[model samples]
Target: MNQLNRTTANIQTIRPIKVIQFGTGNFLRGFTDWIIDMLNEKTGFNADIQMVQVHGKRPATEVEKQEGLFHVITRGYQQGKIIDETRLITCVRGAVNPYLDYEGFLALGENPDLEWILSNTTEAGIYVDESDIDPSQPPASFPGKLTALLYRRYCKGGELLNKALHILPCELIEANGQKLKECVNAYADRWKLPDGFVAWHSRQVHYYNTLVDRIVPGYPSDEAAEIQQRLGYCDELMVVAEPFHFWAIEGPEYLKELFPTGQLGLNVLVVPDLAPYRTRKVRILNGAHTTIVPLAYLKGLRIVKEAVDDPFIGTFLQDALHSEIIPSMDMDPSGLEQFAQDVLDRFKNPFIRHQLSAIALNSVSKFRVRVLPSLIGYIRKEGKLPPCLITSLAALLVFYRGRYKGEPLPINDTEEVMAYFSDIWKSGEPYELVPRVLAMVPFWGLDLNQYPGLSNAVIREVRALLDEEKVWLV
Candidate 1:
């Protein structure tokens, strides 16, 4: 089979490089680059990407070998139909690692056509490094590198306002774009870049806080040979992702013209504020995953699909979503419910073998962020505790017992958290355990015992779960 490249794949044309992308990872390739390719084809947004490796000394050899051509294989269920499709992506012009070729990477900033900066250096990628004070060498941090690039661009273009770049960070952190801007400013201050250049950056640079959603389980090694055989091309850079993709950018409405993925039947949204959308995702999709893991795993389900397929677990998840999660949110219930249903459908996707144990990692923090908000919201709104969520909390407490059915359960958390649970569970009594856990103000942000009847309800549920009575099911 021919190696997947521009020539072997019969890809003739390449667009002008308009985007300098950081992090040549699967999530960015599968989600953002895929959208850009579609936009180029459908909306005549003729632009390509200059991929950059942010970490380590190694450049993306696959991208280099393939001449920036790869395939994104999207497989999953959406709207009750199974979707399995592949597209050859040709938007990436090439990749350069700053550590390997600092001059080449910095030279990207001088491109006259380059208007946008895109990145997904994970949540930790955006941070201030006070020691990154030299522009002569490649800085260690992502924002430091970006500040250097921006300085180069500023100097190259004589600090022209029009030369300022549109930065859209796809990092998972909240206010990622804003945080990146802060880091850049910190670097500028530390490096003592000219006042004029700093002013130009402050006035002209566009930073957009964006929320990206897609499950890009990269490099499907187990099925790579079969996939390559089907395509008749060996693609080392192939990325596997779910069909569902959404990008919510908190920016001006006019910025839509730059993207325009909405017109291409894509789920990209450019709005004045994306808090509602973020809340919706956190409360419903993430909430569902966090709520299901402990309980479903206790029920002997190892993977997400199996848990969602089981009648009892599936019903429990559904009831928790429609009855508790959605109602807890302030959005239009109809839209919320639709999104909740779609989330459930996504969970049932067979292509993604989402392990419950993986999701179980740091579940205490996950529960605090994902599920606790809805639980509190339900109490505040309806003046009562949500049954399913309350039961799930009990299940988490039970799951933290470190063993189930005389076997060690896959409980992954910090040593401190593990120790806390271990020491607390020594009582072997729900009555004693429930109150101590409930009063864990440091964990849950407040004493959960303050909520009337919360401790007692959890005690009952914990007792039920421990006894294997199935009374909660009844």
Candidate 2:
């Protein structure tokens, strides 16, 4: 028997219905679609997931050629031991490029079978400018495109309010579903769509604020050959992620009855609020990443696995997250600690080699969003600056020094910050720069001088690191 072509060997043989998914990239295939496949297997949900490309740049021809078949390789801790599981996820019935197939994309709304519209268009996908959204193209922004589709659906269904989709926005921002809903309303007004249609949309559609967590490191291109050989089969859409995953939805309990995500043992939930979960994860896991990355990488660790595997670096990071990071969070401490532990475990997963460089993307914005808040929170809560996060801030300044472990770091920062650091560091009085940098009110929103001893603390640690110059990183 030919193993690859065997029908029973595949997992996505479910009856094709309709699920218009935005962003058909590896993250979705490996993360959301993987869970959908499992739900199908366990709950007998006849689901059809049709993905549409969010951007026009990525060529969809090759991806379409793969015939919607993919493999998800899950590896990490299971019952205190390492386990790797390979599951063929075959639920993607078809894929459409909204940028290329504008007609087809709009027509998806007309399909009465289309039940849900799921999206993971990243942090920037929700905001849609009606003017920029080429009427020809499915609109530039995710919300604009979605709004256009919803309008069409309303018209096509003739006020069939029942066909409105349950929107699950898997974006990174807080209140993503709510934001999307707001944008849809904005589009209706901007495009001058009929009032009945807008009112009908208001009545028909439902959007839930969601929080999805999974270490979808995405495609394992470098290890694809090895993975394929180990599995004794080939998969074009193979995704490697840690075993730990979470999906939190903010909505009524009846939503679960419709989606049935929990039937498959998924961590999916329908809660009154996802805010607490979001706060906990963002502060601990995301805060740890931003805080640890610059420090660890500057100390010479390349990948997250190494950063966590090495005794000193790993222990340092773990301490920082648990002691400093978790304590700073306003959420329940015990629950936050548990979540942090799971996050650490996910970081240590052998399956995903999460690169430090990749994590370092948009470091300036990252520090502002993920780390700075923790530092401020720690000070507010404990009446003193947290050591680890403060140290991480010092590390960030050092990392921005435009050099890294005998290699050019290619440091990217705003011209203002770069010039400020450059002008200050050149002042011959080098050690004073640390205090000056800390005292720089414009850099941080609040004055560091008000922090009692924060400047001295940062200056002392940064100077100590520079003076000793020993690589404490993994």
TM-score of each: 0.97, 0.89
How accurate locally, in lDDT, is each candidate? 0.90, 0.77
**Winning candidate number (TM-score):** 1
lDDT digits (tens) for residues 1-474 of candidate 2: 123423535543556656789987767887888888887778857787888888865557645666677688887864467978888777887688777778888888888777788999889888867465445556888888888788778877653567667889999888999999999888888788899888888887889998988877777888878887776766566788778888899999888888898777777778998878887777788888888888888777888878988887788888888777777777778877777778778777776678888877667667877888888888898887788887898888777766644566646667887777667666624368767766665666656667788877888777766654545423
Tens digit of per-residue lDDT, candidate 1, span 1-474: 999888888888978999999989999999999999999989978999999999889768888999999899999988889999999888998999999999999988888888899999988889976667678998999999998888888888743457657899999999998899999988988888899889989988899999999999999999999999999999999999999888999999888887788789898999999799899998899899999999998888999999999999999999999999888877899989888878987898989999999999999999999999999999999999999999999999999999876668888899999999999999899998899888988899999999999999999998888777344334
lDDT of 1: 0.90
At residue 328, what lDDT does model 1 achieve? 85
Give the range of the ten consecutive residues with the poorest summed lDDT in model 1: 465-474
